[model samples]
Target: MFVRIVKMSFHQDKIPVFLEHFHSVKEQIRNYPGNNFLEVYQDKSNPGIIFTYSVWNDETDLENYRHSDLFKEVWTFTKTLFNDKPEAWSVDKLVTLG
Candidate 1:
């Protein structure tokens, strides 16, 4: 499995808008081909900072999604709300404990 994490910092006033947009599209994103899971998180110390954690079948699957129209639509609106450039990481899971 492939894991992706993205960190974004938004203007304080835009947080609610972003959350509303996210809630509306999260299901579509999660159901996209090759996507295994999706989640969003907010920073404890900084409410404007958000993170998205997702699982993909592989890098190809992720790349495909990145190039898709859905991505373009989501990113277009999302980037407008950002206070800082987003950061992302793609990684392999080392281990998980139950």
Candidate 2:
């Protein structure tokens, strides 16, 4: 399994725009091929900082999604709202608990 995390910081006023865009695409992202899970988190002290956590079956699956048109569309909209460059990490899971 592959785990991906992305941290995005938006302009304070652009947060709502980001959220609206996220709401529109969240389902498409979750339903995309080989995706296993998706979650969104917000920083406790910084409302404009957000994180996306997702799991994919493998790197190829993740790449496929990255290359998809949906990603292009979403990312184009997303990057415009950023206050700072986004950061992302992809890794193999070390452990899990719930």
Candidate 3:
């Protein structure tokens, strides 16, 4: 599996709106095919910053989701609230220590 991380910074006033939209669609995203896990985090020091961490079976799965209508809808609304350009990374798991 591979991990995907997206960091987004939103306008201060848009944080709550973004979170409301996220809560409404998070379940659908988590249940999408090839998705193994999904979680969201807000920076403790910066409430306007958010990060989405997800695991997928492979790149193809991730790409499919990115191209889906669900993503299109989510992104369209999400982009409008951004205070800065989003950053994303897809990386292979190196190791996990308990």
lDDT of 1 by residue, 34-89 (tens): 99999999999999999999999999999999999999999999999999999999
Better of 1 and 2 by TM-score: 1
Clashing pairs in 1: none
lDDT of 2 by residue, 1-98 (tens): 99999999999999888999899999999999999999999999998999999999999999999999999999999999999999999989989898
Candidate 3, RMSD to the unseen true structure: 0.8
- Model 2, stretches more than 4 Å misplaced? none
Q: Which parts of model 3 are misplaced by more than 4 Å?
A: none
List model 3 lDDT by residue over 11-47, tens digit each.
Answer: 9999999999999999999999999999999999999
Ten consecutive residues with minimal summed lDDT in candidate 1? 88-97
Question: Residue 93 error for model 2, in Å?
Answer: 0.9
Q: Count the backbone clashes (under 3 Å) in each candidate.
A: 0, 0, 0
Q: The CA-based lDDT of model 2 is what?
A: 0.95
Could you give me the TM-score of model 2 versus the true structure? 0.97
